[model samples]
Target: MVAGKPFERWRVAGTRRRGLTVRLIGGIIPIVTLSARQNAGRLRQRQEWQFFATTFRARPGLAGLWWGIVVLRGVLPAGFAVAMGVLIGAIDDGAPLVAPLALTGVIFLGMQVLGPIHMALSRNMGDQTAAWLYDRLTDYCLEPAGLGHLENPGLAADQAAARDFDLGQSAPPLRLSMGFIADGIVSFVSGVACALVLFGYVWWAPPILAGCWLATHWLLRESGIWRDRNTDEVRRAQQDAEYHYRLAVDPAPAKEIRLFGLADWVLNRFVLRRRRLHELQFEATRLRERSVLLSLAVVLTGNLAVFGAIGRDLVGGGLALGAAVTFTQAAIGAVAIAFGGLNWSLDSAAAPVAAVLRLREPMATAGALPAPSGPSCPSGPTGSSGRPGSAGPLTAQTGSGAGELRLRGVTFGYPGTGTTVLRSLDLTVPAGSSVAIVGRNGAGKTTLAKLICRLYDPDEGSIEFDGVDIRRFEVEAWRAHISAVFQDYIRFEWPLRDNVAPTGAPDDMVLAALEAAGAHGLADLDTVLAKGYPGGIDLSGGQWQRVALARTLVAVRGGAGVVLLDEPTAQLDARGELEIFSRVLAETRGRTTVLISHRFSTVRMADLICVVEDGAVVEAGSHDQLMRANGRYRTMFDLQAQRFDEPQEVGGDVLA
Candidate 1:
């Protein structure tokens, strides 16, 4: 028995030590995990703050004023509560009503005065932030060295998602961010003050209330995350909805919609897409409802326990009656203020704030390539990983400015499609010559032009300038070597001078270009191109074409090595086409030019005529040589010629 007693004592000592070690490690593990998570959270939060800070620093005075107001807001709420408590105590002691009433009046008046000032500050902040963000977005989109991102499906979808939400809403992310941060600060400060007041009554009360609030906060945060988790789905649905809605109402499609009687069909499609979006939103609402209900239940249970304890203390003389009344009001007021601030500030801001973060993260690393003028271009163009003898530098060609271009085994496909638009197409255009590309629609003629302008690179093979792989040169610098006018050219709605500004050309040079393009009759330097502006007038399609051609001529005048004209005279009258073509022939003499057209008049004049069919050059020769060969070009030319020669009947009269 004596030996067993010592054994029991030894066993107890070892077990206690083991238990102590296990408990210590278990306790420490959570602390360590929590610390790491907190650090990560802080780091992420710091980055978000830094993004806003970068923007806010541009207008430092506004930031300072806004922050001052936010800090004052924090102090005011706690001050008001404290003053109320003191006033209540004074009233209980039969103190003067004047002091309490004066104090309360000042607090109420300040809050009321803050309303307009806060609104003014918020409005100013929103406008400034929107302008800055729009500039940033524009730069980000336009400055990419390549057109790949613009063509990328996933990136486009993400953009549609982020951009679709911002339409017509005054509450931008940055604007809401300001209010959210301010309200959060106010809530924290007020909570602390309230906690301190409650601490005097019972040390344990503050901890219980904090725990309950934290639990509620966690649920709210999770619910928000749940809503954001499916943004891609939401974005896609929105795009579909917009597409259908446009089909129903857009002026461009109005004629087709009415003739086809597609109003109901389009509206139905819009409803379906919007319904899909609403379903996802409905799911989010349910999650929010669940979280809210649970939070309310938790609050009710915790507050009941707390109030009951306080009541017991009051009845037992542990707390004075007046102090009890003050405590009760302060406690309830603190909870209400904190909850109100959080609910109003955080909920509306969540989606927008998250979108900002998501957008910044993706775009930060996107389009890493940039175009800059320099000599950092790869020297060995022949060694650029492609088929041998494909292409090399400009010096490798017969002569400089001889209009030499080589497409060696080039292949490409548009995004989201496996079908190749250009397949292993090899062709060479000699310097000081013109090549006309004739092809059916979808024959990759426009795609070839995009490649030469460095808008898109070939998936396989090489497009060489002179003899060098074009990709080796900086995109913008290389693009400066080419002038192009596309078929569907844009008519910018800016002043004529502004549209053509930054060209570094003198007025005489610009006027010469305008004359060359037959667009000299359009309004002058200060004239706006749209109808809403005073003295503004919209141009016809042909006039717009002339303006677009003038823009191209400016590029050519600035010494572009090559010129690309894609149906440049498509919208012009027969005489107008002849005039523009005459100018093109004269100006582009002694330089390389690639013209894409369906008309026989221009194609027959090319030094070399190539027929692009099924993404390959199927026929090539000079006009006379192709006629002799009696191939694809000859057949197409004969067919077009026959059309003009055929007789036509107009109102029962033959017009031959």
Candidate 2:
């Protein structure tokens, strides 16, 4: 009882000392000063760590298994060293070897088993995390009701960083780098455990060894390249290099490159840009020789001092041979805390994650549309523009079909460009009538079409539909009533049926639309549109244009009451354009149609023709009336007709 009392008192005293030490550490932590840049860097790192933690929430079971393996892997090195020492001690005492051998074998087996499992888990986790980031980016990009955000050049850097994060151009892909991060974590933990094990031999030796090993991180900064290489100049170089690489690889540029004999030029440019990128990275991350030497000296001194003390104790019979062996292994394992590629992998992984998170608010704000203002505005589920939906709140409440569309005092400019594309433009299309807008390039013809389609809103005007402001209706609900084919239409590498009827329509409807667009019999409905697929064939530019027209026709058949065609027949010759435009008029006889075109043949077919000049409608009339008036339209039409009648030299330049 008396002995127990003294032991209890000793325990209490030790607890008090530990508590006091913890308090002292807490006080010191608050007093440490950090520069503004350092604080920001630490905050960013913390946010990145938080993002990484959230990835585990997606698959709890797998995450649990991964964490278990990590713990086992971390402790196995220390456990193996202790087991070896135990076996040696048993052998020297002529004790049973079976128990010690079994322990050592178990630890060794854990090391082997946990390694592959850890690798697989890291790979899967990294892939899932990358997928999550992509989905987030997609949602953020599409969440806005307007196209302003997409056109903003200021956000391009963030977009590029997020998109190229897992592409292995800047750094190792997350899948491969994830394994490195896991290994680093395990190594760090193992080192700390080894240092703790050394505590039993000598109180002061563990701190000296651990401090020296950790000091290498501050001394050399060998991973500075990965940490600081995401600067603007570096990013621009990467972009330039990637562009050159793409020129060599992409099929779209292959013909031009071969025709122009630009292979050597492209290769040289790529090499130079890559070399410049390397030079910049090296300039940012170069190590100082003096710091390296100092780090080496410090580490060597600490290791020698610890080792010399252990040897002296063992040789003088103050320590057992088994104890000496255990301490020696711990001391060596403590070197795992030294700086290595872990920082490089970690910084690279965190950069893209941080970039993606940083863009959320800016992208959202840029793409946001003003709220519907009038008391009559209807609210409903936001449907997609390309897909059909049941009659929504806007239509159900207002009971308005496609009616006379009017633009009053409209002005607009693309985001991030100081130049205004449209200034106080005004025009009107009577209900169930066709109007063709004609103008020289850069005269706001396409801009007017975009405004009518509600892809963008004017800066200072109101667009009215059926005597009510268009903004009084929900964006998606209003878009449901219109179909459009832009000049730059998407050529989806999907089957013909899917391309024509992207949201699924009746076969008869699809066929009828295809026939109307002059796209029938071009290919089988099941045939893929790209040559890369088996049993697929490529189409000419004119053929693809017809396919785009058929897609718009399908949307019309699904109850859309308005049509917008922007340079829709540019790929077709004059005769083809006339024939296609005839079919289009027949198919959309009663629908309100707006066309933007440079071809006078297609323009003359419209019921009303408006000539745009300097961002305004300078002339409006029928083709005969315009010719009689001898206005801008007349001069443009005469010039085109005269060109067609005249023949030029074989190698002479042609108007585009």
Candidate 3:
């Protein structure tokens, strides 16, 4: 019985110790978790602040001046408070009023003078930041050798956000929001300085008052006043709103909106999208009742405690009137650090900055071309990476000759699409010769052209230049050798001369190229293409096609050895297309030429004709040779020939 009692007593004590240990751990877990969360938040804020600083550093001179002004503005508030107290003390003592009054007046004048200068500086810095960000965006978008990233659906949201951030639909522009950021920084500095001044009266008072005011931030966090609200929902809403707004404002859609009487519909859609975006943003960043009450309670308790102590000291004659007034002013100033506009303003500015930075790596990866499988060749004058912009004028290719082109066992498909656009295709174009390709729609003719241009590499097989794989050469160097007018060519809103020679050429050369394309005398060299500009005139569809051809011709004249015409004359009629092709052939007779067309009349003029079907070449011969063979080419040609006479079994296909 005695042994059992001892054992029972020991077991009971061990159980009690275990309970104590568990209780200690339970109590400590919340503290540790809260500390970790707070630390993480602080680290995030620090990183965001660093981004702002880096953006400011983009223009060092302007940023330095801006910082100088910020510090001066922050100090002015405390200076004004002290000067007021000193002037009052002078009055009470019957001392000379001139010096104290003059001091106070000087501080007030400094305060007034600094405001406008600060605003001007902020505006300039903000503009510089915008330019810096734009430069980075351009580099990321253009640095890639291929067009893959530009077409990726996954990056569309970030791209839109980065592109249109300054439009003020999703967030305030950096130009206006930067001033708010400055004000926030000044407020925090003023608060800390004022707390220091309060230390002169009572050491304990500053910590208690500062702690209470700072605590309000934590207590009122649920108010969502200062948090970043750039959730996925917000970004999606922003993109939708931006799309609707662009549809209403852009010139391309203006005609349809008015012609179809969709003006009201577009306007209503834009309004609804904007309203939805605003609603989502607000929902993410609206104040809550409980957080507001907690914040108010904390603030009230801190102010009352600090002020009541000051009152007691004054009434008991423990402190001088001047000191008491200064302390009171300091106490009021300390509240500047409490939850305010700075948090939200920072949020707005930081969101875009963070987004732009985050996109840099992924965008670069997306845009980058797959590494070449063959041995690398020495880059042409276009540099090692083969960036197209670095290429020299046509005069730079003085010694280069037209090279033979060949494709063997080539296969390709676009990203995210399950179907292949080109199968194991093979063809050869002898140097300085012309070959024309004819195909039904979706027969991979345009895709073949793009592959040859190296705008995309083949998925399998090889496109060779003079028996060497095209991938072995730098992309820009290979591209510099070829010029193309695509079916869907760009109509640059630049001047007529620029439209002919985007990278620039001699005036005589540009004029000759324009004349060849039947685009000469359409407009003046300096006339802008878009009607919105002064002295600008819009061209008809056929005129634009000629201009696009002129662009390719100019490249050919400069030194390009290969010419690709993919339905370049589609905007013109059959007669016009025949005339254009004759002129084009006359200009590019000696150079290698690849023409993709449906017009049998024009197709017959080529040195050799090839027909593509189901992503592979099914026939190859001359116009008469293919007709003699009575193959796919003959059938398509006969169908088109019979089109003007009688209705055929086939409806309108590419043959038509």
Candidate 4:
């Protein structure tokens, strides 16, 4: 759980042993078509090449090592067969047993020792490569560029597949591909040697082996298709299992489920999904059992034919017992190894290819967006020639003082929503000013604050810093001069110092800001803040709000020119709200401030008040001006001010 360790690394390592165990268990079980037909597609040649190049590039050393091991492994088995055959021929022909027996035992022992070493090394290397690939894919998915692409459901599903796919199968594919090439070479050499030896007796033995191999190859190709189809079904089942688990465990729905006594209903839904998975698995199992039985039948029949032919030769004194025994053992071992290598290669290639394709989809889409050029001022009145006024000094002068902020003709919408949240809103504040935005729910007050902070860009119009267009500057650079406490502000699981610091580290400036914001005594700055863990503490809503305010003050002290407070006192009592605001006003003199609130008392203190309704600025003026005019602002102010005496609920009407 340490930062920057990458989630994929932990998942990959944790699941690797389990995946291999599953494969081994499945290997022993009867062959079933566990793959789904939906997964099969015409392989793209370009993609194939890209997959090869990328895998090789990522693990060039491992690739070379694996290839060498495969070649050695393949050659050793054939060499052992030839040595055994020579030793048997000599013994049968009345040669001394000591020399031949010693040489034959040494060769067999060497092959046995080397086989395990090769398997161990290849497995270890494959695991390392899979881990590295998983990390790379995770990084690609998490990059800022991929954010927009994640909105696509298809892309999200593909990513989910990649993450959920078993990476333990990764090593098998790599090992099998190399193993196949090596086995093919060894098989060719052994076939030629056997043909030369058997031709003296009968030219038909080599041809029969070749025919059996061709027939098995065809069967294996068909089996590969079935396997891929079954894999898809299993993947779907896994997805369903995860969905059921989430529904059962998620916090948001727990209360509703408990209230309605729907525990059995949720459990039944989970059971139904799992039952479907079990049924699909049963079908796959049946199919695999049949396939294995058929394969074994073919293998046994082929061996019988060879044995029958050799028996005739022995009866005629054409071949010795030891020679026939050694040939049969070596040939059968080679055939079994070849089939295993091919099956592994064909079945294991899909997941890594799918992962790479999924990653590329997001990366390509992100790359196509138009790059934001150099900082260009966002279009606004401040940048226009009509407003040639210098609002105020750029930095803090001496004593605390309020600053000014002006917004002109701003319009904005959430991305892809096709509905404007704020439209043609204009407001202004003079130096040493504090303004509150007040309106009913969906009044666009929160939207206005976000636009000011540039968390998003305006669809039309602009926001200004002093007399300059804020958009013209680098986005981060402009944000550095603004401090905002959002309604949905996140509370990070870190020490209090980080929660209040200008950035992540503690500084003298952070301490000054925390004191000024009236939040310094909540807890020791060194105290770690996290929930549901040893030594972790949870803060109440009010205390968290205070900490949020402290975060903004830290930003302000670090040279933020503007401060946006969105419902800063929503969690506080009336007295606490007044005290916090009063301290903020006193300590943040000379700094421009925009406050968005439902409380009339909080808004009335502002030098300018703006009333937003239905995404437009319906009224704007000083608090006194608006109240005297008896406009939209006046009606809302009066309605809220009356709440204190009426003993009515606060925020009820405004929120409604």
Candidate 5:
């Protein structure tokens, strides 16, 4: 019996020491500071609060309401604990139970009743903030004047990341940060209250408990990253897997994919490849979960020791009944607050926040060109109004405003690839003439056309209309007078009237343009071509080509000074292509028309034919002149003609 007494005393001493340890080291354990730099170098300098500040500034009233709710939610536990402690303490002191019971009942009921209302308010606030982030980021992306960032690979990836949040493929950054804010404040405030209660029993207990909480939060956050990781294999596997997946789903490959019967094979490949890509991330997440659970285990153990010390005093006639209830709940609250929302918000915000921050630098500097004059191209801005903006380009006629187009030392290259596509090549398109430019693919025909349209500036040259540099005039003002039909063009899903009359041309004018382009029976001006409309009618590819042709003709008939057709019939069948070219050429006789085509039949009718080779005009003349010259144009034309005339043969045997 004597030995048992000493052993019991030793056990009591050990428990006291453990309790004392928690109080002394409160928050002495370090917090894991999450730096944006860890994700991408550029994100390190970004302000994560951009979303908050923008929303707050835009809607201060809403912001105030949100802030009030979060703060109240944060300190709810602390408020409840203080009120409960008062009620219990009064009872222990032998005061009347009625007032104390009434107060406690009110406090308990308010918490339960207010929970749902508080949650709804919180959700509304999050929705407001998230919506602001979406709109602000979206405006920044689309407002750029240039198309460079839109097509760049690095910026494109950032765009994709940002769009994921817009499309809800990922968590909103504001929502994540809110969880970090609201839940983290709850945990901290409640924890501080608990530690303060522990302070009365032991001077060291509060600090020790705070320290354990900090350590638990930090350790759980970095458990997956507490050790070194190999990432190369993961990234490579992911890229390979994504490539296979894209090939299977992308519309560009749909025809070939079915022809090759690759549906099942590629689908199976995608499944296997996705597994490979996820291998490392899955393992890391699992490891982190294990580490968090393990940390929770240690924290609960320390908590049990503290609770035991307090419970012993309450039971053994050394502690007041009110103090016992407060201390017991405080210990549980401390642990509960420690595990609440800090890690989740921090982790989830990483991707979207990184995208938001990194995108600012690239997108801000893009599209910095001079603002467009207006939405619609103003009529006769160049000389029609006796001013530079009036009839110079848009209202210019062949002899009156439009003159010879001259290129001087023109040079250009695609973005990211510095290899020059156009060199120091000079050419002229005389006014009141029909000119045809023919070349092999990538011989700079398309680039030349784009330069004329001023989609991109020439690296080191000037293109002049009417002896004045095209750049001196506003870009859209100059382009407004030039009607261009490109090889690849959109067949818009709208009414035929809307498609042909984007400038809101009159019904009579629209009918005239349609008739000129040989699109008589396809659709009238009022006919809707969209599938979803009340009376929409679908048009075939050939019919659509005719519609696009009519649209171009409307621009020309509207007094466009110059007409450009770049392989306009490339998508049509051979006979349809030939027929359309013949009609358009006949329709554009007196206007300054520039046609780009490979088919010699189309080129044969041009007033002047120019052969482009290696970014220079190698030959120029009428058909008879070019045939006598026997240069690149003549050779190409003969080769095409010969193919049609010759009989098919295999190994010196003609096919029967």
Candidate 6:
């Protein structure tokens, strides 16, 4: 927990001392100083009240319901205190106790029943409100405009904070905070009522109780500051832990760790990260325990003061014995109720603050980009533009099948990187033509695919589909015609059918795709693909590649016209690669195909081959044309071909 302001610390010390001089010097000075500092802080920072107010305005009815529950909660506790005081006074007065006792019992029962019911209702309402916020926030984050804003690290950090700490726990604290506010109102009213009754006996008691209530409220405010700081630390530590966990356990690193026998090393790293998180949590727990103990001591001291005051008033005959007892009980009950409200209010505010902060990034990013502009379509022969005869076959033809893809001096770079991955290199693929991109490692083949899919925009130049600049086209509409089978394709943990038909039911298209990819005969479509289950089936690397290929084919047959294959046969043998390529060519007879590979054999089959060297196309032509020229393509082909005949060192691994 962060240290309080010097004046605030002194004020807390004054509370412990209960000296008039200390209160005047420490309490007044510190409060004034803190108030000025708070105002200055507010001026320097972005006011979050606007964000919260907007949230409240959007859900006014829900907010009102939550507030109502809080009021009920507060009323119940105050009612209990009043009933207890009345019952105690009647018993001490030596009057007939049956009527008072019955009334008190009824109030006690009502308080007990209403308190839990109110709490339950508040919890349910809070949960629904939180769910609504989560859905809205997620929708905002996933919006195209939101994606642009996520490019900023600050926005990303805010997003992470909200997800890790805010959404799940937001409701509980907010509900409690509302409840505390309601409780405070009821406690204040009850305190006033008790004061009026006591004033007829002794006027001094009301002021003392009020003074203690004010002191405790100050302590609670200070505690809230500490708790917020601690929460921030805990959130950071949890993020660190999550990062380490991903590094240790993610699928990308699994093969390397197993082959290198580094399981123990990875486990140790995870343990160290978890230990650091635990240390932070332990420190927070210790501070909280200390605060609770200190608060308990203060409460005890206040009780002792109340008892001494009551005894003195009774002996002086300034108050009757029954009245003195009633006053003391009322004073103790009022102090407890007030302090409870203060404690709950401070703790409850943390969750809402965290929730608002968490939602800030998504909200700020929302509506950053325009909606996807194009006609929507179900699986059929129609294109995104909803024009008849526009949905052409996938083949080598000028604007007859798929669509011509033209890149005019396209350039791109990854975020935070100094060097560009793709330079201003122009290339063109005629509609329905098979185009091959041959490049060494880090030569930007995958980056080109991402650009084509509109995952990113080029730093310079433009990509066009059928002469239409991709940026001007609806992003979703443009992507609907494209399908990609990347080198790092995900193997879902679902059944084989789901793996094939990711977006729909497994129909004839799925069957055709699986058969074309040479995996249909191996197992039934209903076979479970995941391992470690009763009837689970795990495929080898080559088989998984076949499944991935099948998935791409299914997408193509469904509606996609342009297919991108990034090292689709990286895990396959020479024969397997040839067979897969042959099937792809046959199945996608007229579809536009962009094949990214390092294999010379695969590149040789393309209608046009673009050999990318150092992020630029250095050589491009048909296989025979390039061979006749005997340049980079011929030399690379010769080198790779030699590996089949005789053992040779393969230089610079292509698929990293």
lDDT of each: 0.70, 0.82, 0.81, 0.63, 0.68, 0.67
Cα lDDT of candidate 1 equals: 0.70
Rank by TM-score, descending? 2, 3, 1, 5, 6, 4
Instruction: Please give the lDDT score for candidate 6.
Output: 0.67
1-656 per-residue lDDT for model 5 (tens digits): 99899999999999999888876664343222233335454453444354455457546787777667656655566556655776788877887778777777776776675555555655565667667667767777776645555655545545654555434333344543554555655566667766777676667666667767767766765532311112445434545665686788786688888999988888999888767655544454444667677777777767767877888888898877777777666666676446654344543454454465567767766544444354453333543322112344345344433457788889877666666888887878888688889989989998888888777677788887767677766655677777788877677778898787675777787787788776886776677887668888888766777888888887766666678888887767677777888888777766678899888887787888888888877888899999998788778988888777887798999854
Candidate 1 weakest lDDT stretch, 10 residues: 381-390
Kindly list the per-residue Cα lDDT of model 6 for residues 1-656, writing each as its tens digit: 35768878888988777776776887789889999999878844532343334346547776676566555544544455556666777777778888878877886787677666666654554455455556656665675532445554434444554554333322234444444544555566555555444454457656665555555555455443334333565556556666667767687688888899988887887787667766654443233555566666775676667668778878988766556656665665566444444343433444444444456555554325344445632222334432212353222223434878899999887554567988987899987889999978888888888788777787899998777676665555566567788898999887788888776644677788889999877567777887666588989999999999988887777656788899998999888898899899887768889999988887788899998877778888999999999998888888888767665445864432
3 versus 6: better lDDT goes to? 3
Per-residue lDDT tens digits for candidate 1, residues 1-656, read: 98899999999999999999999999999999999999988866653454446446547788778767766765565556666767877888888878877887797677667756876786677557556656656666676666665666767655654554445331335565555555565566566566657776788777777667666767776443335323677667766776787687667699888899988888888898877766765455444778888888887787887889989988998876667875675566557333534443343434443454456545544544443335866443233221212234432433333457899999998755667899999989887789999989999999999888878777899988777777777565466567788998876778876455334456776677788888886778678988878898888889888878887777666555578999998999767888898898778787789999988787787889999999999999888998899988889998988768988789999877
The TM-score, computed over Cα atoms with residue i paired to residue i, of candidate 4 is 0.66
**Tens-place lDDT digits, model 2, residues 143-257:** 9988877778777777777777789867778888778878987887888778888989989998999999988887877644454466877767777777788898899899989
What is the TM-score (0 to 1) of candidate 1? Answer: 0.79
- Superposed on all Cα atoms, the candidates' RMSDs to the truth, in angstroms, are 6.5, 6.7, 7.4, 16.7, 11.6, 11.7
Give the winner by lDDT: 4 or 5.
5
Residue-by-residue lDDT tens digits, candidate 3, 1-656: 98899999999999999999999999999999999999988876563665566566578778888888888888787888788888878877788999989999998999899888888778778778878888888888899888766766667777778887666777788788778888888887778778888888878888888887787777765553534355676677778888888898888799988999999998998899888877766664666678778778877887898899999998999977777888888889888878343567777777777667667888887767765454445444454222223344221433344667899999998765667999999999988889999999999999999899888888899998777777776676778778899999998889998888888778898889889999889988999999989999999989999999998888777667778999999989999999999999999977889999999999899999999999999999899999999999999999998877674455664432
TM-score of each: 0.79, 0.88, 0.83, 0.66, 0.78, 0.73
Off by over 4 Å in 5: 1-47, 54-63, 87-134, 170-203, 223-256, 265-301, 316-318, 341-350, 353-357, 364-366, 370-401, 524-528, 532-534, 649-656
* Candidates 5 and 6 compared by lDDT, better number: 5
Top lDDT model: 2
The candidates, ranked best first by lDDT, are 2, 3, 1, 5, 6, 4
**Where is the poorest 10-residue window by lDDT in model 5?**
223-232
Shift of residue 597 alpha carbon in model 4, Å:
4.7
Distance from true location, Cα of 325 in model 6, Å: 3.2
- Residue 499, model 3: lDDT of 86
lDDT tens digits, residues 1-656, model 4? 47647777877877997899899888866443333322333334333444444456667876677666656655655566666777888877888778778878987787677666666665555455556567777766664321344544444444555564443312234444433434444454444444344443456765665556555655554444324323555556645765676678886589888899989998998888767755654442233556566666776676678768777777887878677766665546536432433343433444455555557656566423333455543322222111112122334321232345667888876654577788888888665567788889988888788677765566788776556666665554455556789888878788788888725534566677677767777667777777665667888888889889988876665555567899998999988898899888776666778899988877777777888898887888877888789888878766776765566445666322
